[model samples]
Target: MAGPQETESTQITTEAPAKPATPEPKKKAARSRRAKAEATQPAVSKRSRQSPKAAEAPAPATRAPRKTYSEKERAHKLSQIEKTIVGGATIKNAVGQAGISEQTYYQWKKAAAPASESDDLKDLLALEEENKRLKKMLAEHLRKENAELKNKLGLA
Candidate 1:
């Protein structure tokens, strides 16, 4: 039994008790309310909602060339790649200038490693060259000393 102020919608008559209005949960009520509100407005399709370029077909992805070269040309290209990379340039730019892929450039560098020469062999060769130069210098110094000693000893 509701007061006269209550409308027909809220009136509780003596007739079979009307089902009590189920209280909606806060989250679901808010979401359904929003959906109902949006239903009144016109909706744009996904594609039409995008920029004008959306209608145009995308350009095909470009692939880098896979070119082969003579051994001499390959050497030249490797030098170009190494120079650019060691000079603080990007590997992509260096490889581009060398007309090779980054993979090829690394392959060339790895292959350039001297298989016959170990670290010990390399050190020995360097030391041998240094020893040879020092020996020549020592010979000259000894010759000058010998000449001075002969003159001093009256054997000149």
Candidate 2:
């Protein structure tokens, strides 16, 4: 039989493993209170309506439009024009060498010519007027389609 001291040691070794300590209840109560507070707060609306005057802010002033051209494009066109004038290159040859369509070259020439006295400038102005007319026609078509859609949806 074991001695008293041996028995005590044996009892300590054979004792069931200690259970994990339970967390304090106060932390859980605090988290639950925070969740309840958030739940009670009002939700924000997604759609907001603005006053008509505020919505209709004046558009920015139109700035003078500048032509966008690459250095290669400018050089090629200038070279072609030089060739045509000095080397007696045909209009077709000049356009081909410039890497642009014949019509485009003519249009550029017309636009660049003197506005006061040149017939080419008069032709260019006529083309510009025609372009305006075409744009107006396209805008009207789109407006009609928009009106039709609005009527169908009962939003007119």
Go through the candidates in order and give each one's C-alpha lDDT. Answer: 0.77, 0.71
Taking all chains together, the TM-score of candidate 1 against the true structure is 0.40
| Model 1 per-residue lDDT tens digits across residues 28-52 | 4445867886886657578665868
| Candidate 1 residue pairs in clash (backbone atoms < 3 Å) | none
TM-score of each: 0.40, 0.27
Q: lDDT of model 1 at residue 69?
A: 78
Q: Relative to the unseen true structure, what is the Cα RMSD of model 2?
A: 29.7
Q: Per-residue CA lDDT of candidate 2, range 1-156, in tens? A: 889999898777667345335754665444587788777765534442255653575644656576556656755686667677688878788778766668777766665555435767788999999999999999999999999999999998
